[model samples]
Target: MDSSQRIYWTAFYTKPRNEKKAAERLTSKGFEVYCPTRTVLKQWSDRKKKVTEPVFTSYIFAKVDETSRLEILKDTSIVSNVRWLGKPAIIQEKEITEIKSFLEDFPRSELAHGDFQAGNKVQIDSGALSGQSGVIRRTQGNKAFLIIASLGLELYAEISLNHLKKVG
Candidate 1:
């Protein structure tokens, strides 16, 4: 592929509860899409059942070149490309791989939104996210929610306290 056709993994926001549909539509149109999902046991008054849900509620990633990027916007389910600093946010391939590996290893993990407060900077000393540095966004019990910022996007993960060391 030429420079203009070089594929980039770009993040996009989908309409509410339309992640899977958007992924399917984009894939059918020959776009490589990744809609990370995990299976979890959901309990209702009647019974418990396993359900698969998107890891990122309304977000999906697509591999698109410069021209194809615009084409994706034409899809009704796709709200728009995730932008940071007035440009499309390009996600790194390694980060996407890490997310997939994390979901496989921790299928029951939960994603939560916490207050965006300034906190100490720390580096992961061990485990899957080892060597990654992020600000400790929040903490509850033994888990610390970290915001790892890259390419103007924030990747949030709840990590064990034992795996982090406060950066000097």
Candidate 2:
């Protein structure tokens, strides 16, 4: 029974795109839950609408103590065992927090990704590429990729909000 209520990598089988619902159910049970989702733009005949979709498909995260494993397993929405190396895996709370933070702060921070594409000017806002200029790309999910336009190649790295800032 850790005070942090350590996180676990659960291999839950959701109801075919019902991951969010399942996560919510578990959350209400007093378990710390995480289901990373993003709003995707869908163009309809009438207009464009942003629909919330799960990033990891059927996967969801939960934080609990060892004693709660049985209750979690008994959960109606969670269909499979949480796993790691052939056993129920215990993921540290730190990793869950980091991923959550990245999703939340994506708007303000700069982003970088590997593989360059056309018409991108290279710019590196952080790391070895920091302060360097490169091709910038406005990609899906508000992610930006820095590439070398001349080479038509993107830097071989994918960074989220954690290590991103637009180069001045």
Candidate 3:
């Protein structure tokens, strides 16, 4: 591929509960897709069962070149690619690797969310809180206090240190 056709990883927003479908469609169309999933055990009145679900709801990653950007956007399940400065957001390979490594270690860890705080800005790449951005208030052992801002509220959550990556 030429320079203009060099492939980059991009995050695409899917319709509600359509992350897997969107990934499948993108894959079937010969594009590399990533939608991390984990198995979680749930309890009910009768019994408990393990269910596999997407780590990041309404979002999936795709490896595509600039020339194929419009083609990938044609999928119905994909609402649009996540953008930065009016352009499609390009996710770094290192961030992707960190997310994969996190999933391998904490396949079933619960994700916590909260608002901003005073510390280094970070992003949760995997788990229930994938796609959330926050600040690291502190870290004790393997646990981190994350302050995530959402819906105009500052929320605080304690998460694993391994699940976080410094956001650029």
Top of the candidates by lDDT: 1
Compose the digit string of candidate 1's lDDT tens values, residues 38-69. 86555466765667889899999998898999
Q: What stretches of model 2 exceed 4 Å from their correct place?
A: 1-11, 107-168
Query: What ranking emerges by lDDT with the best candidate at the front?
Result: 1, 3, 2
Collision pairs in model 2 = 110-164, 116-154, 120-135, 121-134, 121-135, 121-136, 122-133, 122-134, 122-135, 123-134
Per-residue lDDT for 64-168 in model 3, tens only?
898677788899998888999998999998888899999998867453222223497999988999989998887654467988999999999998766787786
lDDT of 2 by residue, 1-168 (tens): 564464455545565777898888888888777888876554455765667878788777766555666677777777775676886777766777787788887732222232334345545556765655655554433355555433555554443323454443
Error of 1 at 2 (Å): 6.5
lDDT of each: 0.83, 0.61, 0.81
Clashes of each: 0, 10, 8
Q: What is the TM-score of each candidate against the true structure?
A: 0.61, 0.56, 0.61
Q: Which candidate, 2 or 3, would have the higher TM-score against the true structure?
A: 3
